[model samples]
Target chain A: MKKNLKWAAIFGSVLLVCLGVIIFGQFSHGTTSAEIYVDGKLYKVIDDLERQKFQSLRVETEHGYNIICYELGKIWVSESDCANQTCKKYGKASLVGETIICAPHKLVIKIVGTDYDKADVTT
Target chain B: MRNNTTVQKIALIGVLTALSLGIYAVEAQIPVSNIGGIKLGLANVVTLCAMMFAGRLAACCVLGIRIVLAAAFYGTFVSFMFSLVGGVLACAVMCLLIGLFDRKQLWVVSVFGAIAHNTGQLIVAAVISGTGSVLSLAPYLAISAILTGILTGLTAQRLWFSPLKRFRITQTRDGK
Candidate 1:
């Protein structure tokens, strides 16, 4: 391979990866809402939670149950009956597209704040 | 002198496999934080070096053994799947590029190989999670691959420049 071409291929691949990240970021931007899913289906969508401020919810699936706590614009799994405490131990999630998954329960909590929902000023 | 012979070749492959496994075990012990699938993958140094010292087939053999042994010793089915795919992809990419450039440019080959490895892992991650959102990590993993690849490639380069050359069989001048 030509030396110049080799260099181009290396830089080109990096550029493509960066572009992909940018596009994904733009599409998933904002964190005004949180979408909860169970077994690949939409479970619930918590929107404009700032009005209520501190909010908590319980999500129970056939596999088990989870207590999700939302406070100060952050979400976390405070309790789960699943054998693996990975979700409970995940701590806090505030970023857009961030997720807390309880695999055993097949439950997923994903941040999906759209631009119109407004960013949480308190955070 | 240990000239090119079937027994010598097989012995070299065995030694390389052992070295790769040793490095892999050590790497597995290091603590990782907020893992987005980033890894040092230092064991790849032996895989790349095997290409330079033995051949493409020998490198594949080394990587295959290392992956199987590692999975049997320290991996779950899920972890084994991830490593098997990543290791196979990385070894294949490196072997493909091994003959394209001289040993001085092994990092180029390694960079592509590492990227391929990460891509493989990312795919497995997405499939296991049953979501494409996990792909958001692609860019981050790619960047990390470049850095780690350079590190492992330079290590292999140094070994090639050292007395390790004496261990190289009298087969291909470029050693494939």
Candidate 2:
């Protein structure tokens, strides 16, 4: 019975993860808008109002790098002068539990909900 | 067989704890993939070693001391609780599961450890935040855990079988 329980727990966890991926994928399907900025100046506006509600703002720096930001969340440099492209691969972060960071570029992308004072995992 | 002296036991635990802290600090300095709290978890190597060498109780003691010391050194007591609960639960699960496998199956143990660690942390986060939304990141964390676990486990397997395997004085029958 104990052995069965362990296997059951493992399978149950895996199943829940699959379900979560599907649900999150759907939640990210709504059209959202984003504003791109370079050096603290407005560069472009990705007006994809028909895209996902959690639209990501992608900024290409003058140094041939990209910074991504979620319209409903925080801003982070997705790519920069680093051999390891860990940040760029992180893609877009929109949920309260999501984050994007470029340590070399000191770029941080975070998600801030309507209630900033709420007890968030980010804190 | 000669048992470890009190001084030797304390020293061993202390050294293991220090090594764990060093791994934590070093990993903190590196800017890895930011999936949010996804870490190399190098300190876990030490925890795994402790479980292999000492008994499960000793492993738990070392983990408890390491978490408390790490929290006091770097973050707050609240953060310490998160690490303590997560590390202890993960290590316990990993040790128990690994008992079923031989040395060749160290990778399996590593994978279990990483998954357990993430699960423990997520549970704590859910409780602290009072919301289940943080549970959304479980998939991402699981994927990362598997990847890192394989790497760390391979390394650990090699370390365990190496000629310099002076850590374990009295190996468990299952360890063979």
Identify the candidate with maximal lDDT. 1
What TM-score does each prediction get for chain A alone?
0.69, 0.40
Deviating ranges (above 4 Å) for candidate 1: A1-9, A12-28, A32-113, A117-123, B1-4, B172-176
**Docking quality class, candidate 2:** incorrect
Q: For each candidate, give its TM-score against the true structure.
A: 0.73, 0.63
Report the number of the highest-TM-score candidate: 1
> Taking chain A of candidate 2, what TM-score results?
0.40
- How far out, in Å, is residue A34 in model 2? 11
Model 2's DockQ score: 0.12
Which structure among the candidates has the greatest DockQ? Answer: 1
RMSD of 2: 10.2
In candidate 2, the residue pairs with backbone N, CA or C atoms under 3 Å apart (3 or more residues apart, or in different chains) clash, namely A30-A51, A30-A52, A30-A53, A31-A51, A32-A52, A74-A110, A75-A109
